[model samples]
Target: MTDTHPELDDLVLPFSVEPLEARGRITRLGPLVDRILERHAYPPQVARLVGEMVVLAVLLGTSLKFEGRFQLQTRTDGAVDMLVVDFEAPDRVRAYARFDAERLGELAADASPAALLGRGHLALTIDQGSDMSRYQGIVALEGQSIEDAAHQYFLQSEQIPTRIRIAVGETLAGARHTWRAGGVMVQFLPSSPERQRQADLPPGDAPEGATAHVVDEDDAWVEARSLVETVEDHELLDPTLTSETLLYRLFHERGVRVFEAQTVIERCRCSRERIVGMLRQFSPEERRSMVGDDGRIGITCEFCSTHYQVEPAEVGVED
Candidate 1:
C-alpha cells in the first residue's frame, strides 16, 4: 500500500576502511534530517543541535539490523525540551527537535549540556514489525556533551565501544552566509576479539561455530576505531567538507575500503490509521475531558509539530 520513498536517491555519504585494521564513515545529512527539522522554522542553534541528533541516528541506525527502524529520543527540561530522530530504511528516515524558544536563546549565547538538558534521560528505542518486540535502552544524561552521552549509551546498553564527535551550527553558504546543520559519529564495532576469550570457557576453547564471527567483528571494530581516530572536529563540521573529503582528510595515506551508502530522508511516520488508533484509546470520559465545548479535540505531534483537529463525530464507536 505504500509507495517507494522518493528521497532515497539523495543519500550519498561515503564509507571506508583503512590499513591499520580500521575504517571510517561520514554522512552529509543535508538532504535528509535537516529538511525535516528546518521545516519547523527552528532557530539556527536549535536546528544545529537537532541536526546533529538526526545524523547521529542515521549513523547508529546504519550500523544496526532492523526490519523496521531505530528511534533515538532525548527528553530534557533544558533548552532542548524534547528531541526525536527516526532512522527508517527502504527510505523513511526523518527527525525533529524541539526546545523552549527562550531557553534556546540563552544557549546560543553560552550554554552547557547540563544547562540545556538538566537532569534528563536519553532513550534509544528499536521498533521492528509486530513479529519483533521493541527494545529500548535508557541512560542518564550526566555528561558534559551529547557525544559523551552517546558514547556512554553504546558502552552501557548495546555494549559497543564507540567514539563520537558532533558539531552543530549554521550551514556555510559563503564566507559569512550560513545555511547548514552539522554532525559526525565514529564508532568501534562491539565485542572486542580479546573479550571473546571469556574466563568461564576452557583455555584456548573456541566454540564450534562462533570463532570466525567473533573474530570478524573484532577485526572490523579495531580497524574502524583506528581510521575514525584520525578525524578532527573541524573536518567534521565543515559544511564544505563532503563525506569523501572528510575521510580523505583523515586517511589519505591509507587505502580505505568502502561500502554502499544508504540514503536517509525526512519522512514522518504520521498516518490516519495511526492517529485513529491512538484516538480510540481514550475512554469516553477522557475524550470529554480533552474536548472543549466546541466539541473538538486538537492534537499535535510533538516530533513534527503537525496539528490534528478531531471533531466529536470523529470519535466514539462508529456504526
Candidate 2:
C-alpha cells in the first residue's frame, strides 16, 4: 500500500473497510500492459477493451482464494470475436484478443464496449488443477462496459453488492508512448444470518434456516455505493496517486485498511513440450495431415507469439 517496490509497474492491492464490513481490490498496470498490447499490435479501440479485461482479470483473480489459474473470457459476434485474460496464481498475467482489423479500423475512435463485442456472454472460470473439477459462472453481456458486466455477474450469480470502476489508455512519457490501466472493486458484506444463508443458496431458492428474508437496502450499503460513484476516470488512471493515498481520499471517514501488495508480471505458459503433448493426442495419419509444405509441423502461441516446430518422427510418424 505504501509503494514498497517503486520499481514495480503492475501490482494489485487488496483492502477492506472494516466499519462498513466490505472488502475490495485495487489494481494498476503500466509497463506490463504496454508489453502485452504491443505484442498483439491491436487497433486502438480493441487495445483499450483488451486492457480493461486484463485489469479486471487481475482484480478478480487476486481476490480469489485458489491456488491454480483464473481466466476471464468473452465470446461475441461483433468486430472483436474473442478476448481472453489468464491469471496464474500468486502473480502472473497475460491477455490476447481476436478481432477483424479492417473493421476495427473503420469504427470510430470512441466505440462503446457493446458496439465492439455484440450479443455474447462473459464467463469466469477457475481451474483448481487436475484433482479438482473446474468451476464456471456466466452472465449475459448486458452492460455499457466490461465493469458493468462484471457487476451484473456478481449480483446475479453470487447475490453480492459490487461496484467496479476501470480506466485504460495511453500515456506519453518523454518520446515513448505506453499503455496503462487501473481499476477498483468493492463488495458489501452481508450483515444478517438469513442473508448469508441466502447467499449460499441458488437464486430463487429458500434458505433452510431463514424464515423471513428481505433484500438489503440499508443506509450503510447506500452510502458506500454513493462514495464509489464519486470516483472519476482520471483518479483511477493517474500514475501519481498511490493506492493507499487513493483509498484514504475515498473512504477516510468510513475507515479503510490496506494489505500487502502482490506484484503482477507478464508471463506466458506456452512451450514446445506442452505443444508436443497436445500433438501426441492425434494418430500418425492425423498428425501428417497438419504438416505444411516445409515438411514440419508449426504452431504459434496466440498469447506470446512463440513459434514451435515439430519433426515428423516426433509424433510416431514412420518415414
Candidate 3:
C-alpha cells in the first residue's frame, strides 16, 4: 500500500470514499517539520503547538483552489499569543510562533490548545494573486485543540461537515530527535442538486408529513464522522504506515480512492531583494527611524529568522 515514490516524509494525499460520499486530505510531515522547528529553539509545549499548526495549515490549505498563498493565523491573550503558518501553492510552507517565555514555562507539558492560546480568533486568509481579491474567514477559538477549531471553522464558514484528526510529537531515532506530524481531514460533499436545494431550503418548506431530504445525507455524514472519530493519533503518526495503507485501514470497507500525492517542503519566501523593495517604500524619516546605532537597517524574518541588513547608501539615504 506504500506509494512507489521515494520522499514520503513531507507529502499530502487527496482522497475520496465513494461509498461514504466524502472527500478528504491526508498529510505527513517528518523532515519538513523538523527542519522548520530546528530554526528556532522553542520550548517543548510551544513546539508541539507549532507543529500542530503546521500540519493543520497543510490540511486546510491543500483544500483550497487558490493560486498564491494560504495563511493560518491566531492572535490570543494566553501564554502563546500568536501562531502563524503560510502555505504557498504547489508545496512550500513556513511557520512561526510568539509566546511569553515565562508564562509558557509555567504551563504544564500537556496544556490544551485553549489553555495555551486563551481567547482569540483563528483566522484563515487566502491570497489568490495580486490581481485577485483576498478572502478571509475568522472563527472563535472555542476548542481544546486546533483540530476542534478547524472543524468549527468549516462547519460555520463553508457549511461543510468536516472532521479533522492530527497528531504531532518527536521520535527518537538512535541518538537524534526528530519531529513528526500527521493529519487527516474528511468532509462530506453534497451529492446532488436536490440535496443542495434541500439544504438551502427553509425547514418549514418540507412537505407535510415528509422528512427533510437532508436527514438522509445527515445520516451518511454521521456515519462518516463516527468512522473518523475512531482514528487514533498513533495510527496517523506511525512512520511505518503508508498513506494508502492508513486510508485503506480506515475506509477499505467504504471503497476509498486516492489521487496523486503532492510533496511539501520547508521554504521561506524572505529574500534581500524583497526586503529591500519593501524598505524602499518607507519615507526617509521612516527609514532613518529603523537604523540602529550601527548605522544600518536590519530586518529579521519572523518565520525563518533570517536577518537582512541594508546600508543607508543602498537605499539612496545618507546617514
Best prediction by lDDT = 3
Question: Candidate 3, overall lDDT?
Answer: 0.85
Per-candidate clashes come to 7, 0, 0
Using all chains and alpha carbons, the TM-scores for the candidates as numbered come to 0.76, 0.90, 0.90
Candidate 1, residue 98: CA error in Å? 4.1
Tens digit of per-residue lDDT, candidate 1, span 220-280: 5555566565666566555545666566666577665556876656777886667767987
lDDT of 3 by residue, 32-107 (tens): 9988887898887888899999999998777677568999999999999999999998688999999998898888
**Model 2: lDDT to the true structure:** 0.84
Per-candidate local distance difference test: 0.63, 0.84, 0.85
Q: What is the lDDT for 253 in model 3?
A: 84
What's the distance in Å from true for residue 103, model 1? 4.5
lDDT of 2 at 105: 75
By lDDT rank, best first, the candidates go: 3, 2, 1
Better of 2 and 3 by lDDT: 3
